[model samples]
Target chain A: MTMAADNRPANAVPRTANRDPYTPQTLLEVAVEVFNERGYDGTSMEHLSRAAGISKSSIYHHVRSKEELLRRAVSHALDGLFAVLDEPAARHGRAVDRLEHVTRRTTLTLIERLPYVTLLLRVRGNTGTERWALERRREFDHRVAELLRQAVSEGDLRADVDVRLATRLLFGMINSIAEWYRPGRGDAASAQEITEAVVTTAFGGLRLRQ
Target chain B: MTMAADNRPANAVPRTANRDPYTPQTLLEVAVEVFNERGYDGTSMEHLSRAAGISKSSIYHHVRSKEELLRRAVSHALDGLFAVLDEPAARHGRAVDRLEHVTRRTTLTLIERLPYVTLLLRVRGNTGTERWALERRREFDHRVAELLRQAVSEGDLRADVDVRLATRLLFGMINSIAEWYRPGRGDAASAQEITEAVVTTAFGGLRLRQ
Candidate 1:
């Protein structure tokens, strides 16, 4: 799990504020939070300024438009996820091992980049940025589906289920983490613990003696 | 799967137009579709009217407001899910069997009530009705979590994993069906086939020889 933290993209900003003044990264963190709270369509510059305790002009100073903030936020998330595929483990391992590595890392990335990924999931193809995000998301899913197909061909996974459906369910289980996983909430599991449970419960099943 | 079709609620309106005129149920179906395409907050009575090819006054005659349509849509989905718990298989069977029955039925209900469930899943707690829907959704999750705990206590499920986390992942996988599942889409599996895949993939897992 520490490795998961270490692997977070250098550009990935922590959710908490560390300074009295707002930087672009901090502003982005605040904007993404507000975006998640209020849908992208519902949010306005006034909302962002009020939430940031800054002037509307100050917001414009940081970003040209609200869609810019959305683009930056989702790009951050997409970048983090896409980077996982380039890791040594994901690139050069047995098909199942590579798939597991990607799965665990993807879970960690979602946890680390919680707000950004949540925004990415909520996008409704309403804008150019959102449509681009959707297309990139499809490309990512296709890549993982290919891995699943390879694993099945390698005799590592069950042959009974459709490979594509299996991939959707697997990622579905992973993506749903954003809905309920509140970091630092009451008795919440740490990222490492969640990664382990997700892998085990998903691949190992709930049945005893598996 | 035919059993799934037969089990559709008496009040469940077909997605297609069957009558020459509109009823409240038919109006709701149209409203929910537009609400999903354009988010609930983003949609207007004019949009609903335009999609339904009727005057805005006609829409008001069928429903009081947009919020009413949202409340009605989610309540329909919630009702269908809660009814699954009342069935003989869910109430009288062993904990494992009951859990499996609930899981399978939840998937089928989500499919049968696709548009409504999709709207239900996207509610962001921005309105009174959304808040109510969120509360009802939490209550439903709590009920299923209790069942998982019972299954663990009965020695039917793995005890290593946390029950609450397991339940969230379980429903997360199930709830995500709304994201990519389009009924009558290219070579899509039947509802029964999907239910079987969800059960087997979720409980049996993708690992070979498990």
Candidate 2:
């Protein structure tokens, strides 16, 4: 297991062989890993260089600072999540159906972009970048909550439960995946299996029987 | 809001007057507040002293070390949780009913002991006490999983959903209260309201219909 060196600032760019096409992506991946291990505050540029086999200067070439890397990483996760909302299935279906689609897609995205989402979940808003990411996250949550409220209004969901509470319960199930999931483990249960379980658990009493 | 000073090591105790019984509890309360604010790794003994309105040496008389305070705080939360299992509702009811009771009690405990539970959830096993706390958390999860399995066996829960998955889903709903719940923010939504919402949302996906 390669660990980032402790000397330089965490976001430092490593001396790359050359300007590679994947430098940004590669550097971001390394940065996410270091951020997870040492935490955003504890990681240093020297650490990134050792992890990425690049010099600290090379890292700076990719991103301005550790917070910038954090922003980029969370943005990637948010983009993946929001893109699912724009999919044809997510947009045109019944509210419940759309919610199912969103849940499934969110699970898949989280798995595919586990490191990014993990970092996003860990943000505490100590910096402007973190606060911005948090605000964006709230917006995403509110958007989904609107769909849930629509479902309840359409008489497809139970009226007794609060929409905000229900929305949180649903995503809580989804976001907790980051705490325990490891990529490439045991066929790792496909997103379908996960989304199915989540939907079933969520809609069991929530949905009106067809 | 008062913030804990971050000048002391994890093992150093604060010094204080020997006669005050409330001093230890007050100091501990202040310590937990600081732990929640800056996180255990980021906080120092000086932070606790300043937060408690006492000198650094004063804190030492009550607790042996910073980790001891963490151990004590989370232990209180853990005991509150485990005690629910000993309640008549949890011990004597049908599997589904017992599970619901446990869920309700756990949510209430989390709210009533918010800071301790928050600190508990944030622990990353970086030290002996932290690792132990994490193990206890897993044990708590496992015990709940057992009750869930019993519910499934008694035909009180959907068998289609994997028991482990369901357990995680349920606890995810409950544990998530720590992330956003504040002590005095909402009107008409008392602590009871939050706990009931969690129980309703959780058991809605659980509990076999009549």
Give one digit per residue, the lDDT tens place, for model 2 in A50-86. Answer: 7777666777878888778888889998999889989
Task: Return the top candidate by lDDT.
Answer: 1
lDDT of 1 by residue, A81-196 (tens): 99999999999978988999999999999999999999998887889999999999999999999999999999989888898888889999999989888887778988898898
TM-score of chain A of 2: 0.84
User: Which pairs of residues have clashing backbones in candidate 1?
Assistant: none
Q: For each candidate, what's the DockQ? A: 0.70, 0.36
Local lDDT at A121 for model 2: 88
Which stretches of model 1 miss by more than 4 angstroms?
A: A1-20, B1-20
CA lDDT scores, all candidates in order:
0.84, 0.77
- Fnat values, one per model, are 0.75, 0.37
- Name the lDDT value of residue A133 in candidate 1: 98
* Every candidate's CA RMSD: 5.7, 6.1
Weakest ten-residue segment in model 2 chain B by summed lDDT: B1-10
